[model samples]
Target chain A: MKTGIVVFPGTWSDRDCAHALLEVLGEPVRFVDYRERDLGDLNLVILPGGFSYGDYLRCGAIARFTPVMNAVADFANRGGLVLGICNGFQILQEARLLPGALLRNASCEFRCEWVQLRVEQSDCAFTVDCRPGQVLRIPISHGEGNFFADPHTLESLEANGQIVFRYCTADGRITPEANPNGSLRNIAGVANARGNVLGLMPHPERACEPLLGGDDGLAIFRSAIHALNRVAV
Target chain B: MTYRAEVFVTLKPVVNDPAGLTIRGGLHALGFESVKDVRAGKYLSILLDEADEDQARSRVEEMARQLLANEVIEDFRIELQPEPALAESRGGGPS
Candidate 1:
C-alpha cells in the first residue's frame, strides 16, 4: 500500500505520523507538501495534526484553499482512503470533505492528555480493525475539538452510521464527564458517507507504540493496510 | 471609489459558543450584574476597490459566503461604512 502524509505550513505532527508509519507500521510513506497538486497516485493519504497556517482566519480556512486540498478532495472523490487527525480533522471539515464543524472546546481550555474512545462503526476502512464497542486509549491536544452539526445532518449521520468513534468512559459508557471537548453526542470522529474519508480530533498517531504509554492506536494503522489489501484482492 | 464594509460573523442559535459563555462569566464576576449574556463573534472590516456600491456589496457577500463565514454553524451580516477621506489630516489641527 502506498501511503503519504500531507504537510501544511503550520503542521507539526507530520514527522510523528511519518515515524509511526515508517518505523512502527512498516509502511513506506512519503511527504506531500501543501503546494503539491497531485494526490492521484496514493492509496492512503493522511492529514496530520497541527495549527495549519497558524490556525488563522479559523483553524482550517486558509489551508482549505491551498493547492494540496484540491488534490486531496479529488483523491477522496475517486475513492482514495483519507484519514484526518486533530487539526487535520478541522481542515477536512473546512474543506467540506466531511460534514459538521469543530468548535471551541466547551470548557474553553486547551486539553492535552489521554482520553478513551469507543468505536462506533467498525465497518469503515479506517476502523475496520477495531471492534464495535471497543474502547481505545488515545491522546487529544487541542483547544477547538468540539464537533457540531445541524439537527438534520446530525440525525442523518446517526441514521447512516457515519459516526465512527465517540468519546467515552474506559468501560465504553457514553457520559458527559468523559467528553473532553463536549462534542455533540460525545462524537470524537466521523467517516464520510462513502466511508473512505475519516476525520477525528484525537491523535491516534501519538499512541501508536507501547513506549508512548499504549499501542491501542496501532489498530488504525493496521486497518489502513487491510483496506488496501481488500481493494487489491 | 473605495468602499468600506464591516462584516459580523456569529454562531447560529443552535450552535454552542464556549468563548462567549466564558466572556459572560468574566463579566458577571467583575460586578456587572446587569450583563445577562455575552455572545462572541468575528468582526472584519473590508476595504473595497470597486467604484459601485452594489458591485462591492456583491463581491463582499461572495467573500463572506466562500471564506469569511461558515454557513453550517454561523451567519454573517455585512454593513457598508463611509470611506475615510484621504484629504483629512490626523487629529485635525492638533486639538
Candidate 2:
C-alpha cells in the first residue's frame, strides 16, 4: 500500500504513522505536507493526530482551512481511502467530510491511555480484517474527542452500520465507564456512508508494534494492505 | 448614521449545563441565594457597517448565523442602537 500522511504544522503523529507503515507493514509511506495539493500518487491518505494550530478557537478549526484539505476532500469524493485519527477526526468533522462534531471531553481534561475499541463493522477497508465484536487495544489522547450529533443522525449511523468502533472495557463490555470521552453511544470511530472515509479517536499506529504493548493495531494497517492488494488483483 | 449591535449566543437548554452549574454554585456562596440558574454565554458588541436600523439588524443577524454562532447547539439575538448614542454612552465626545 502506498500511504501518504498529511503533515499540518502541529501534526505529531505523521512520523509515527509513516514509520509504522514502512517498518511494520512493509509498505511504502511518504509524508505529504499540508501545502501539497496533489493526491495523484497516493493510494491511502492518513490524517494523523496532533495539536494542530495549538487547538486554538477549537480543535481542528484552523487546520481544516488548510490548502490540502480541498484536495483531500476531492480525493475522498473520488472514492479514495482516507483515515483520520484523533485531531484528524476533528478535522474531518470540521471539513464536513464526516457527520457530527467533537466537543470537549465530559471530564474537561486531556485523556491519554490505552483504550479498547470494539469493531462494529468490518466492511470498511480499514477494518476488513476485523471481525464483528472483535476488540483492539489502541491509544487515545485528546481533550475534544467527545463525538456528538443529532439524535436523528445517530440513529441513521446506527441503522446504516456506519458506526464502526466503540469504546469497550477490557472484557469487551460497552459502558460509560469504558467510554473515555463521553461520546454519545460510546462511539469511538465511524465511517462515511460509503465506507471509504474513516475517522476515529484511537491511535492504531501507536500500538502497531508488539513492544509498544500490543500488536492489535497492526491488523488495521494490514487491512489497508489487504484492501490495496485486492484492488490490484 | 451608525448602528450598534449587541449579539448574545447561548447553548440550547437541552444541553448539559456544567459551566452554568459552577457559576450558580459560586453565586450561592456569594449570598445570592435567589439565583437559581446562570447560563454562561458570549457577549459581543459589533460596530455595524451600515447605519439603517433594519438593514443593520439583518446584517448582524446574517453575521451571527455565518460566524458568531453554531446553529446546531446555540441561538443568538441581536439588538441595535444608534452608534452616536452608543458613543455618547461610552463617555466619548460626539463624532
Candidate 3:
C-alpha cells in the first residue's frame, strides 16, 4: 500500500507514526507537508497526534484550514483509507470528515496513560483484524479527548455500527472508570459513515514496538495492510 | 461606511464545560457563594466596511457562523451599529 503521513505545524506525532509504519510494520511511507495541496496517489493517509496549530482557539480547530486538509477531505471522499490519531481525530471532526467534537476532559486535566480498548466492531478497514469484543492495550494522551454528539447523531452512529472502539477493562468490561476522558458511550474511536475514514484518540503508533511497550498496535497497522490487499484483489 | 460588531460565541448550556467547571470551583473556594455558574465563551469585536449597517450586520453573521464560532456546540450573537461620525472621520470603529 502507498502510505502517507501528513506533517502539520505543531504536530508532534508525525514521526512516531512514520517510525511505526516503516520500522515496525515495514510499510514504506511518505511524508506529506501541510502546505501540499495534492496527496499524490496515496492509498492510506494518516493525521498524527499532538497539538496542531498549538491547539489554539480549540483543539484541531486552526489546523483544519490548512491546505493539505482540503486534499485529505477529497481523498476520503474518494474512499482512500484515512486514519486520524489523537489531535488528528480532532482535526477530522473540525474538517467535517468525522462527526462529533472533542472537548476538554471532564477532569479538566491532561491524561497520558495506558488504556484498555474493547474492539466494538471489526468490519471497517481500520479494525478488520480485531476480534469482536476483544480487548487491546493501548495508550491515550490528551486533554480534550472527550467526545460528544447530539442524540440524533449518536443514535445514527450506533445504528450504522460506525463505532469501532470503546474504553474498557482488561476483561472487556465497559465501565465509567475505564473511560479516560468521559467520551460519550465510552467511545475511543469511530469510523465515518462511509466506513473509509476513522478517528481515534489513542496512540496506536506509540505501542507498535515491544521496545516501547507492547506490540498490539502492530495488529492495527497490519490489519490496514491486509484490508488494502483485500481491496487490491 | 464603517460598522462595529460585537460577537459572542458561547457553549450550549447543556454541554459540559470542563474549564468553566474548574473556574466555578475556584470561585467557590474563594468564597463567592452567590456565583450561580461560570461558562466560558469567545468575544470578538469586528470592524467592517460595508454599504450600510444592515449589510455589515448580515455579513458579520455569516462570518461568525462559518469561522468565528462552531455552529454545532456554540451559538453566536452579533450586535452591529454604524460607527460614530467622529470615529468614521478618524478612520476607526468603536473598540
Candidate 4:
C-alpha cells in the first residue's frame, strides 16, 4: 500500500517513519510537506512525531493550522486510514480529528523510554493484527503526552471501544506505575468512532526492527497494509 | 480605530496542572509556607484595527475561540481597551 508521511517544520520523525515504511516494510512511501494542500493518491497517511512548529504555544498547536492539515482533515472525512504518532497525535486532537487533549506530563519532565502498551481493541484499522489484551513493547519520547478528556467524552470513548491501547506492564498488567505520562486511564492510543483514524503517543516507527530494539511495532504497520489490501479487494 | 487586547488563557479548573504543581513545590522549598496554590497559564497581547469597540471585541473573541485557546481543556478571558493615545485624542476632540 502507498503511504504518505507528513513533514512539518520542526517535525523530526518523518525520516524514521520513512525508513520504517520504505526500508523495513518495503512499502511505497513519500514525504508530504505541511505546505502542500494536495495529498495525492495514497492508501494511508502517517503523521510522524517531533516538535512541530517548535512546540510553540502548545505541542502540535501551531502546526495544526498548516495548509496540509486541511487536506488531512478531508482525507480522514473520506474514511482514509490515518495514523498519528507522538506530536502527530497532539496535532490530531488540535485539528479536532480526535477527541481529547494532551497536557504536560504529571512529572513535568521530558520522558524518553521504552514502555509496554496493551492493545485494548483489535477491530480498528491500525490494530487489527493485535489481539485484545496483547502487550507490545514500544518507545515513548515526549514532554506533553498526558491525555485528558471530559467525563462525557471519556464515557463515550469507553462505550464505543474507541480506546485502542493503554500503558501497561511488561507482562500485560495495567497499573499506575506503568503510566509514564499520567495519561487519563492510562490511554496510550485511541481511534475515531469510525476507526479509520488513530492517534498515539508512542513511536512505533522507531521500534519496527530488532536492530532498533524490537520488531513489536511491525504489527501495527502490517495491520494497516492488510486493511488497505482488503479495501483494494 | 485600533484596539489593544490582552487575552488570558488558563486550564480548566478540573484539569491537572503539572507545571503549576512543580512551581508550587519550588515555592514550598523556598519556604513560602503560606502559599495555597499556583496555577500557570498564558497571556497574549493583541492589536486589532476595527471600526468600533463592539467589532473589535467580537474579532478578538473569535480569535480566542478559534486559535488562542482550546476551549475543551482551557478557558480564556479578553480585556479590550482603546489605544491610550487615541483615547486621549478623542477626549481632546471634544475640548
Writing each residue's lDDT as its tens digit, candidate 2 over A1-233 gives 57889999999999999888898878898888898889778999999999898986567877887899999999999888999999898888878899987876777678999999999999888899989999999999888888888899999999999999999998889999999988999999999999889999999989988899988988788887888789889
Model 4 ranges off by over 4 Å: B86-95
Q: What lDDT, from 0 to 1, does candidate 1 have? A: 0.91
Please give the RMSD to the true structure for each candidate, in Å: 2.8, 3.5, 2.3, 1.8
lDDT of 2 at B20: 75
Superposed model 2: Cα runs more than 4 Å off: B1-9, B22-35, B42-68, B77-95
Descending-DockQ candidate ranking: 1, 4, 3, 2
Error of 3 at A112 (Å): 0.9
Question: Per-residue lDDT for A205 in model 1?
Answer: 87
Residues A1-233, candidate 1: write the lDDT tens digits. 88989999999999999988899988889999999999756899999999999998798999999999999999999989999999999999999999999999999999999999999999999888988999999999999999999989999999999999999999999999999998999999999999999999989889999999998888888898898898899
What interface RMSD do all candidates show, one decimal each? 0.6, 2.4, 1.1, 0.7
Docking class of 1: high
The pairs that clash in candidate 2 are none
Query: Runs in model 1 with CA error above 4 Å?
Result: B86-95
The per-candidate count of clashes, in order, stands at: 0, 0, 0, 0
Selected candidate, larger lDDT, 3 vs 4: 4
Cα lDDT of model 3 by residue, B1-95, tens digit: 87889998898887889888889999999999789899988899998789877788889988887678876678889988877874557675555
Please give each candidate's TM-score. Answer: 0.96, 0.86, 0.95, 0.97
Which stretches of candidate 3 lie above 4 Å from their native place? B83-86, B90-95
